[model samples]
Target: MSRSTSHSFSRSRLAALAVACAAVSGTLATLPAHPAAAADVAIHDIQGATRISPLTGQQVTGVTGVVTGVRTYGSSRGFWFQDTRPDADPATSEGVFVFTSSTPTVKAGDAVTVSATVSEYVPGGASSGNQSLTELTKPTVTVNSSGNPVPVTTVSAASVPSAYAPQGDPAANGSVNKLPLRPRAYALDYYESLEGQNVRVGSSRVVTASDAYGELWVTVKPHENRTKRGGTRYASYEDQNGGRLQIQSLGALDDFPAADVGDVLTGATEGPLDFNQYGGYTLVARELGDLRQSGVERETTRAQKSGELAVATYNVENLDPSDATFDAHAAAIVDHLRSPDIVSLEEIQDNNGAKNDGTVAADATMRKLIDAIVAAGGPRYDWRSIDPENNKDGGEPGGNIRQVFLFNPDRVSFTDRPGGDATTPVGVTSAHGKAALTASPGRVAPGDAAWANSRKPLAGEFTFRGKSVFVIANHFASKGGDQGLTSQYQPPARSSETQRHAQATVVNAFAKDVLKAQPDADVITLGDINDFEFSGTTQRLEAGGGLWSAIKSLPKHERYTYDYQGNSQVLDQILISPSVRAKKAFAYDSVHINSEFHDQISDHDPQVLRFRP
Candidate 1:
């Protein structure tokens, strides 16, 4: 049968057609039909048929399917569901959804009929130019489940699947493999500990979720099918398996009490939360304590003058194309980057060794910054990054945009020597959206010909005050806009949410491996995470993994390192162990703009931290 007809097949039933139709079929053809032309509808007349376009904002009704999901609005409700027509494509047709004052009885898997008003989606649509949905509605449904209707809590840590098995022996397989770029050892260990534990979590932010390995995080959430496969069975079967969250846990949201989405939280009494390039919001556990009526306990503040250990991050405002003024820019950049023992730099250019100047360029801007660092004075700085030369891109090609760290060699030393292979660096996508490598400068990975052309992340181990600190530098895909998704009928362009999570997962894997090598290892992850503390990326990276955000331990003034178009956020950050933060091991800030006279050399300001170790 043609692929279009194959939509009826379930996951287990598609084994034969999977290989036969691989080359014949493109995307399946069961997408939603053009919306209905009318503005209003009679609720009694459309009980069994699929509901398309309705009067733009008029109340309409139909008994189609159960309210499989209900998104509550303080007083009203919203959700989607399957149509009652057996021959109709429930996967493609607008399932029943509702926006009303009543909190309808709906969970992810349970299905019944819903009575909702018909309406067209709101304004913005399309990704990479493909048609997208803004809004759809269903009225209500009859609850068939036992007792009272059990609400499907937005998949959180508190819910555990029945088949869950604790991940023992770090080598054991997890729900998914995280990307192998800069690994997050502590984060991975903590996630492994909760392999089978039941926990409560929230849909903190909408982001691409990935597994422990550097791959996509796939799980089933009722009617929602994330695997991109056709038919509802896949989601139905996997829903039994449960949805997957990242290894990094950013603590509970109750700690910060962010009233709305996209809020940046800092210094909750609960300790630290992890942030990432993907999305998700998070706060520390200590902060959660403060939310209680009893108030926070054991709170302490330190003097800033006592030689604090520092770390900072910045988005170098298109820090590419090496020009003479670039050095002045680099110095100015560093001046703003300031005194953290480590600094994360984003948007650094990469050359695939095929340069017009007859030089094998890594990221020219990164190279120039390192040269400037040496010129300013050596030994105060030393850096390690990954630059694999991809032979596919011509020899005179350019490298990718990437994230790198500039560490004080006098304070930190390398631990993992680059093993001749392409070490999974930190990034998941290049500045322009290519899956390439972007390293600062240092030893090249063995057999990594593509590193020269890509903007992937580069990672390494270091020592400070005789203590080990593993630094994982990353720059996630940007969500600047959806212009990249402007296509007529093409599959949707990769969402920044998903790609960023992929990169975050890659770092999570690196962390897990590190802990496997050293169970009691002391690690610190600091960089330009490209996300806010309360976002999904941060939550998964912190809650799933064990990485901690230093912002939770610091005062608010130092919470954010970059301000764009009035959006003050903590994109650059430093996440350390609870033990380290307790000892006051570091301090950081959104420097340069805050402390210097520089006219914002880059989009991100510098940060500083000081510590004995």
Candidate 2:
């Protein structure tokens, strides 16, 4: 028998029995004799072990016991072991296993013989605080009167968790006949009212579109005419009145190539009642009911012309810099982000530099940012970024900081802008020099850095609500406690203000030029401009450029986005042109999502405005 706290077998037979005993015990041990003898032991009776441990360098043996429970931990790649053997007391059988490999094959309730050398834990000698089992050998074992291994079967549809089952797959979608019907079971309020019900819903009508990860997305309008099936409410997409159904796919517009605006699809309806991932934004699709194609509605420009739009901007402070930062929290980083329909982020480090340990290059930074966004919430955002300035100096490790834009492809279609050798001139000369600015069909470049270091403007045009909207997302110079002649702080040459003011001038000039190009254009300029509403920099845009400030109209208590020294200031803003704001139906609201330090998730808060023009 394997060496144990107690005894049962002799030395000669002990070697062979040692394997069985070792396998039975959940631990390992080493013998005081030859190493070859220890290696030769083959376990026979696998499941009935009382104790198991591993051996040391010396000739030793281990203890083994039947496993009671197994649980997954950490990254879902490992497991822990609990004991439940005949001779083993249930009280001390709470065994914690240290798998031989990072990923183990064994699972709970398996009967096996483990050969190991066991010893008491050596405090902090690297292997956590558990006894050391250097080698875990699986020997021949018997379970439930069977000599061969027990067959492990994958859980079938009947055994699958209710959360992921029938009617969930793409073809069936989230249809009701696929879910277990029970009245008010598990807090399924909407579906509970129709427990044990069967209903027929008309084909769903396509509504607004969304695109994420370069994939196309379409929202379906639920059918409104109601019929009762087993007491459950059933309707078709055409009947939804104004409500919509959202669906996302990983292919481009040409993939399915079947769906079009006003297309009618018929399918069963079910409950995704708890779906609220997008919060206020319609980016996330909650399953209204299963939508199967019944027939097609007449094809028309189903794109409704609503003069209302809600635009939100935020500065996701220095998103990811070096590889070290990216690797450390890649999963957590992806989990917390909320993808707005349109997000204007600032301070996204582009090139690695001395400060960032220079790991993610510009191209790499862009790739990582894209991956991060998708991992957070997939099939929602289709990326359209301005190409980085290849000629600019590469900072720290990642590269230079380059501002970028990630748009929901389904809703907005884009037109790239022009590019040129335009550079943000350095020092005093930059303020006076003719700032090079260009507009192309679908491109932005390194030369754009003249606006902000690692933070430049990303301008693009996309169609929304049957109208083209121009978006200029930028990060401006920071407010570093310096006092300039003007409250907006435009310092003279050689001062920090020199670079700051030059950057602001570049952004302002671009805004003016773009507006002049489309006299009646719907223009939205948003980002961390770093200038308060009361500041002259913004005032100049309001007075001279005729831009409408979104924050100025909000109540004083809700105007601020960030607070410093107990005083709140609206440093970030959204400025719309008079033509867009003048749409009477375009009543706007500015919300301070991060107005309070306690309520803030990041250092900077996100500002949102809803206006239809």
Q: Give the alpha carbon lDDT tens digit for every residue of 503-567 in model 2.
A: 55665665666556556667788877666676556765566655878776665544655543123
* CA shift of 71, model 1, Å: 43
Q: What TM-score, computed on C-alpha atoms, does each candidate reach? A: 0.42, 0.40
Q: After superposition, how far is residue 125 of candidate 2 from its true place, in Å?
A: 48
What range of 10 consecutive residues in model 2 has the weakest lDDT sum?
Answer: 1-10
**Candidate 1 ranges beyond 4 A from true positions:** 1-309, 324-328, 333-340, 351-360, 363-367, 374-380, 389-399, 420-455, 481-494, 555-558, 592-599
Clashes of each: 130, 107
Q: Which stretches of candidate 2 lie over 4 Å from their true place?
A: 1-307, 321-339, 351-379, 387-399, 417-454, 481-502, 587-595, 598-601
Q: Tell me how candidate 2 scores on lDDT.
A: 0.37
Candidate models: Cα lDDT each = 0.37, 0.37
